[model samples]
Target: MTGSTTRLFAARLAGTSVFDPQGDQVGRVRDVVGMIRARGPVRVIGLVVEVPGRRRVFVPMTRVTSIDTGQVITTGLVNMRRFEQRGTETLLLAELLDRTVELADGSGPATIEDLGLDAVRSRDWQLTRLFVRRGTAPRGLAGRLRRRGDTLTIDVDAVVGGVLGLASPDADQGATNLLAAFEELKPTDLAEVIHELTPKRRREVAAALDDERLADVLEELPEDDQIEILSALEGGRAAHVLEEMQPDDAADLISELPAEQAERLMALMDPEEAEPVRRLLAYDDYTAGGLMTTDPVVLAPDATVAEALAHVRRSELNVPLATAVYVCRPPLETPTGRYLGTAHLQRLLREPPQTALGQLLDNDIDPLAPDETLQAVTRQLAAYNLVSLPVVDEDGHLLGAVTADDVLDHLLPEDWRDADEDDDLEGTSGKEAAGA
Candidate 1:
């Protein structure tokens, strides 16, 4: 227990491995449990650790012996029970990262980027410093040309002195810091972070993301989360986000809402953008039509290999959707003129740039019918060794394309997204190790 006072940033501690004195890993840190007071600094209570089964357990600060950049060392027997939040407990990452607070210098409100915890004694730790940012961080061109915001660490007591520490549940908070921290994460990873937050905070964070970004995250979330977050947005904004999502995804989400609510949102959406979603909604949820994406790469039969390559090169296109370019007669959009055939990317690359896509079409495989069952779609993809397949109507017009990912999503267990949320262990607080 005798060592220089240890200081660790909450962000650094997050996800760091926790180990026993014998060098055996116990679990990874999910979050820091702290006690926020009406005055003074927040006291570090324990660490929320996720074990092998995704069960969260508490390891008190009293048991911690070492804090390093990559790992935490603890003494005594570790508690294995589920870590439930007490009335006085706060999850630093889940509740405080994006909180907007007034600075003591009167320079304006700042967003908390990270927090620093210091060991006050062998068994006591306290939140002592706040890493925060202030100023508008405009995105796109402006973000690239200019600096984001002034970030610095200040005494935790500065803002916690009075009633200005963390904002209330309903208070308007900026997600700049939190979003910045998660900027490099994939949509699925970001969805996991958002899934752990409280509903109100989740709504605030969702509101801060742009329509396209929100659409990406929403697609990766569970059905209930998608419904909740979408319902919380203003009608127009919600419609815009839906428009950014894949037509099939947007249709599925809309179908889950109450009829009146769904109608209202669809009405707010641009008619041109809502058309494809509306079309998909007419089909059964488990059918090829419902699972197909209307925005897959499409090209006219006469399009050159170069043009087909260009369409597949779009940065926004997902891998499966970009794997092949559907070559149709005229009216290249979904429900396209004639379902000619698909020109795979590999084939396109092998052809001369000036060669027409129609010459490279792979029509040997039959396209899927809109009414085809999800199981049938899966079988087709597997049997054909294809990443995506075209969906055509009875009239031989292309409706959309069903990708491997879409089929896998439906075939997986319904609670697959909730795999990390399982909390079967029941208990209040976990017991400390056997000995001091």
Candidate 2:
């Protein structure tokens, strides 16, 4: 059955059984599980098999031999007595089940209901994990819903009933239908669907998505989509999404665009909003300096709580929503400012505003050279858990700044390295491959 249905919908495998070579029933498949790596499709690693009248067993895919419509085939024909009943250890299930999984086609979230496994061409065969629909069903369900506009609310009892051949009686059928429909969506169409959603809806969709699928959709999006979606968000919502994106990416989206348009969007945003973007705009778009932002929270070491509060109020207009405040002296002999340490915002807020900034200063802030590569900057930011890193010239003068978001944009799927490699390869070929 696995060979006959190489592309079977994962949701339809909920009730599928597993068997050994001698046609002996082993266990019923409970869930399919694996991690999605950077190199390929989701790799299936094991199956959570529940044997009737017995405990559950986590059968590694290495034990699978083949698959068919009614049952999965395994390598050894062991007796039912030989099967070990493992306790309810959901480690395997937890690894693969109940995750906020996404459909590769539409990049939408679909709950995993169970896993299906079969061994074919290899000793270990990881089967695909089944996905069930939950939460508020997608809109326009008249043609899509199982009962024509009826929402399918998933619960533990409902899931158990569906697997045990009770309840709605058509749950598997409904899931299969939904999976097929989702598979039909093109990448561009998926992006468009995401784009039309409201900010909350967009976040839901993004959160439901896996990183690679999200990256694929992001790669295909037009520049406008990038800017509009990003500009509308703030804090972790904006940061997480952008973090998954490449630095040059977020930069490119904001670069060369109308300054007034960006300004308008920033004006409407809170300090967190206007700051990161404004920092990016400060860069040259073509140079590293042009790609940086300067919205990190800054402080003078001698500032008191009252003074800090005053600074917060005054600088609130330009400062990024920051986790730490940097302490620095104004530029002495250079155009840019000298290097300093940092202070925690939480600490400052907890103290009286009149507290001195110097006492609060943490003097251990990591600083970045303006010319550092985006990759280097990303590593530093991650190491410090910083929201933004200061960029300075060799003389310890501040140039601008680079936010975590900027680093993320550059790290995304823009193919800068590949493009360079291709250019180098073409140069080496020197009309040989071209002539051929």
Candidate 3:
């Protein structure tokens, strides 16, 4: 069915337009699908085709007659049902992109940023080479990665000391064994890598992170990046990640979107998590209401110092929120709690463990009104030399607290958060390099 066929990197296959023999455009290659095996070769299974209107459909390999540079031709009818990854299926784009795999040698895991696919016996398609990037000096790479790290491509067998072939276990593989490597990397480190990727590539990796972990990485990325990744996700998935994020951070992200889209996403969030963000979105963009986070530490007026200290020790509290605890009256949720005052960490340390939190409330620092302008919030923060400032309503109810980071986000250059640094890994592959 083919005049000639040539091997190409799997990544190169992505985004190519697929056409019928009559020259009718069918779709584009979104991902390469393969069937993984326990003790045999992982065979090419099908192509995930992104069809207009339908989004994505599966075209089994048997349907295709030929695959060549930038094109794949089908010999039979293709399945119109959307592709759902099966137990035995591995989606190359989703599973292998930006993945770090254990090396054939015992040195450590090297990231498989790009992959090479060649025709087996010059006929069947198979992943043949791994252009791996190592953080440390190259080991079995024999200076290949270190010397031509930017452009060299080597067969998997060469790196694996001439193993049986791509079918063997001792090869640079896909996502099957990636949990261990990812577990060792901090969220910040992972975020740096994601930042360097295009929105599509970044999303593939982001989808792999757990909700809480994804929240942490989202917070580390710039606002533009945060929006891009979030926009790429389905509303429900975006809602789950937003629910895991700090209320203020989530609100800040929501505020950046068109009101309609933001509202749609917010509706997908849990009622409890959406409440504070909803309130924050009602305020002007430059007001304290917009910058404050509803997840700040809050304690009942009758609570003790020990209770306050323990609350601070809880897993979910970010550093700025942990710096002080707001002592409030009944109806402690946002838009209701009476603004009693704040209890500083220093005061908690000096007071007797059992002392009532209300007794240690500092009256000097005034809680900001939700309508207060950003300038006022800034002046108050500087006047008190504080990193966090609480926001209250007209009825004197505690709403949330704004941290210095939020204020700095506005005062800094519009592009301040856009700087590129590959990473600070002991042997970091410049922040932007690894992700690309």
Best by lDDT: 1
What does the lDDT come to for candidate 2? 0.48
Model 1, span 124-158: residue lDDT tens = 89888888877544432233234557898888756
On residues 1-436, what C-alpha lDDT tens digit does candidate 3 reach at each position? Answer: 3554656667666667777655566777767887655454556777887555433567776667778666787643545555566766776655664454455666555555556765564346676677666533222213222322343455665444332332233222323223223344456655654554446556655655667888989987888889888997778989999999988778888888888889899889999889878887788878998888887888898999999999998877767778999888877777656889999998899989999998998989878988889999999999998989888888888888999988988888766644423333222111111121
Positional deviation of 267 in candidate 1, in angstroms?
1.4
Model 3 is weakest, by summed lDDT over 10 consecutive residues, at 427-436
lDDT for model 1: 0.79
Model 2 per-residue lDDT tens digits across residues 1-436: 3454343434444446776665666666644545443333345565555444332345556666665566767654222221232332222232333333334444344544444443434544433335455432333222133322222333322333232222111221212232232344445445644553344445444544544455456645656566555555553444444444443444456453477654444455455544545555655553446556544456566767666565556632333435556667874222336656666667878897677777776657656775666667777777877767666777776655566555655577653311211122222221121221
Which 10 successive residues of model 2 have the least lDDT summed? 165-174
lDDT (Cα atoms) of all candidates against the true structure? 0.79, 0.48, 0.69
**In model 3, where do residues sit more than 4 Å from their true spots?**
1-182, 420-436
Q: Model 1: runs farther than 4 Å from truth?
A: 1-5, 11-31, 37-41, 45-88, 100-113, 120-125, 131-154, 160-170, 420-436
Quick one: best TM-score, which candidate? Answer: 1
Number of backbone collisions per candidate, in order?
Answer: 2, 37, 5
